[model samples]
Target: MLRKIYIILVHTIRVLAKKVGLLSLLESRRDRQSLLYVRSLFSIYDVDDMVQLDLPWWTFAAAAYVENFLRSKNGEANVFEYGPGASTVWLAKRARQVAFVEHDGDFAAVLRRLTEGVYNVSGVLIPPEINPRQALVAPSGRVGYENCDFENYVAAIRDAGGPFDMIVIDGRARNACLKEAVKHVKPNGIILFDNSRRERYRLAIEQVGFSPLRFPGLAPALPYLEETTILTRGGT
Candidate 1:
């Protein structure tokens, strides 16, 4: 609540200052867009903070990537999303089938609540003690979750029964995130990797054997741009 107020106050001051032609004038288009995005974020919070079920830049970036892909692909396409970050629930809404895997128990609980009643979304809490492979063993009558390393697990998912039509990777584990994604996607399937600019995820994608398509430019009022990379499927 208070954070929203603070952002509003800051925005008002900046606007007035800009009008007076002072106080960090918005010289660059990037800066101008930031202010607008900040305002948009705060406004949603003011009206109903719950309007933001997911976190900021990451959530926005992730949603933008997937929405860009699935909004056109119409069909019962299988989507494998790693990491139950704030955006997982939103991804579920767009994909035909979505399975969310989370390493954190607490974060998983919160996400579970947010995802409740969201059709076609299933939440899995990755147990800590067990290895990533065993832990991933799909639950009783539920999908088995292998408590293996993320990369190996993703590869296994593909080799196991993958060749998915679309794969969205947003987890923080970037090194392995994109690599595993390639293994799962079917030829010609689209893969959207969030935060391409983050911690060298772009470079990571390059090493993973997929071609990434960069955006023309960042849109106005968007939190961050230089981070999203779209990879369209080509021949194997």
Candidate 2:
């Protein structure tokens, strides 16, 4: 089909561009537009300085939706994020409380610095349980992937004191995160799953009976489109 060919061609072009350093150029241009669009969408004009710094993480669409959602809240919503990065700071600035789980100590340290002096933000580093010889596969049969600390990661999130108003599953073992999130998320709360284009994740979302509001498109600084799905209980 023409659509399939187009997708392949686009992917190939992006791969080639990255090899030649042109991808960065394209992303820089795309990021400016992304920032303007997200700012307009969220009515967050004071974050121009933060947007310009180019800290990598969170798609623009995802951030915009989150910012707008938080803005609509009562200013006392607690947030739990499976990954920590720019989103940690973003949530810290908006939410009354933010808790994030990171798998790397060094990254956690840096995130702490980024969120320092922000009393509402907290990061927990739960390193992966590293099983060098073990291979983990998704339900889609994708192989050669592993998240050794996945079980522990889920436990950490559950034990972190929830019913969170919002949960962002953008880190490792996201399917497991989704499963655990069902219990900890408050009624009518939202769960955001980044890169929901994966078949395994899609299936998991369906299995969990979430009514998903899907935002599928290009994210900030990325050369490709991905799905960022927001799931809510009772199909709301």
Candidate 3:
């Protein structure tokens, strides 16, 4: 109940902040820190209904919140959201049109309903029948997504050209996602990982010369709780 209360409070503040045109000027520092600490609360609530990838609720929340901030500041269009995570719903409010990709057909089947009522967002699972080599966008009025055993996702990218300005890699494969990320992500674009807790990601980010942008919380699972560490290729 306390968790719900906190969420309500945070959301209330957010609404009020936006209404009053002071969303970025409020008690945001404390609000951000306070929200991050509530990760333990969201973790127990089962975020599967929101996204197939299960991390902590606070982490997911933090990611969405930070993404909102970045989107507002940078004005990114043509975003390729690679993971089909909880942020897909959140991205609806921000992006003009988002291309959501989910590797698992079963999870995507369930998420399709959740993704509706979103603003200009397209949700499509991988392994398209027409083009088994590429991932499809949403509302194609198509059926039979055959993404179960599709391999060489990089080839799919090669087959489908993309100068995607923003690339979000929030898929289930945390550690190895970057290897595939390099193939699709544009040179000036960004690669944001939803659940960025592992040392491998940290090391890989450094090894690949990607700079850290933001890290919100200490260590929590909520979307809004975790540090939204962003890196724009070599730029911060």
TM for every model, in the order presented, reads 0.60, 0.72, 0.57
> Per-residue lDDT tens digits of candidate 1, residues 1-236?
87666667756765676578643333333235454444443333221222342332343444455566677667466676665544455556666777755656777777777777888767555443336434432221112433334433333344334567776665535456566667667787877675566554546777776777654334323333545566875541
The full ranking of all candidates by TM-score, starting with the best, is: 2, 1, 3
Worst 10 residues of 2 by lDDT: 39-48
Stretches of candidate 3 exceeding 4 Å from the true structure = 1-45, 48-65, 72-76, 127-150, 153-161, 174-176, 214-228
Give Cα-based local distance difference scores for all models: 0.54, 0.70, 0.53
Shift in Å, residue 98, candidate 1: 0.9
Give the local distance difference test score of model 2. Answer: 0.70
Candidate 1 minimal-lDDT segment of 10 residues: 137-146
Give the best candidate by TM-score: 2
Lowest summed lDDT across 10 adjacent residues in model 3 is found at: 137-146
Superposition error at 195 for model 1 (Å): 1.5
lDDT of 3 by residue, 64-120 (tens): 545665575454555666666556665555655567666668778756776666656
Clashes of 2: 1
